[model samples]
Target: MRVVGNYRNPGPQDEYSQGQGGYPPVSQPAPVRTEVNAGRLWAGGVAAAVVAALIGLVGVLVARAVFQLSPKSSSAFGDDATVQLCVVAALAALMATGIAHLLLVSTPSPLSYFGWIVGLLTVAAVVVPFLGSGSLVVRLSEAVIHLVIGIAIGGLVSNAAGSASRLTLGENR
Candidate 1:
């Protein structure tokens, strides 16, 4: 037969470059931008605050009605335990929302970091009443309130963050 080196004529396929198609071309998708809608986030924060306050109020009612725990006078927030817990829950939710926003803008894994921070803060809140000289029922009630507020803020804020996100491909929506 013919010698291998003697076939000097190059075919069309042989002349084709790397990008020419025997195989399909590899194309990378355009980069997308993800941004948080601040207004939506703020609205979500307000809703979370209200919900937290309501949850605290419910806790106060349960403590009084079911457990028969009288509201203890606090040097900090005065005598109305329901009002005090409600205010604390609202403030905590607002603070958590702000922290979540900051984390979302700055971190790659925002919710993960947010959960850790909130969890630690909640633990501190729960432990603070125990460190003070309060009746056992009062301390337990306070701790339970703290736990509920923490859960409300953590869950709601995280969901809000997800809902507030907007995705865009380059300059196009």
Candidate 2:
């Protein structure tokens, strides 16, 4: 007979090492899966839209009442320029949400990509008014409004994407 110790070497056929009614076998951990919750993301998108519209309204009001500035009469939106601005701001928020969702689904480090894209777009919006044939004050006011709307869209949607994603371990059984 051989002396037995509390700890024994586990051979290839050992039942405990094989997880046979004993200690489970050591194995690599399951990979994690990141799942996006669409409902939450869309809800955040809607909130962003409302915020953008409100920003547009307030920006226009401030420019008109406080600074006595207004969009050019020959603008594409014509006489209803304020109303058009609000609508466009809301639409831009929604579009940003769409881009965020798309990136979350298809890319790695999606928020980084989304930030860069939205930032560039915002800069473009801020610059376009200056390029047009408008007075300095009016163009500056328009650029400011666009900047605010872009910032609101980018920030709100990025927060939404973060809150809507969850990580789960892949099935291991």
Using TM-score as the measure, the top candidate is 2
* Candidate 2 lDDT by residue in tens digits, 24-107: 435767977678999999999999999999898888777777765545674432347778888999999999989988988878
Local distance difference test, per candidate?
0.79, 0.85
Clashes of 2: 0
Candidate 2, residue 159: CA error in Å? 0.5
Provide the TM-score for each candidate, comma-separated.
0.72, 0.76
For residues 31-139, could you state the per-residue lDDT of candidate 1 as single tens digits? 6666889999989999999999988888777777777665455332235657877898999889998998898777767889999999999899889889998789888
Please list the residue runs of candidate 1 whose C-alpha ends up more than 4 Å from where it truly belongs after superposition: 1-33, 71-78, 167-173
- RMSD per model, one decimal: 8.1, 6.8
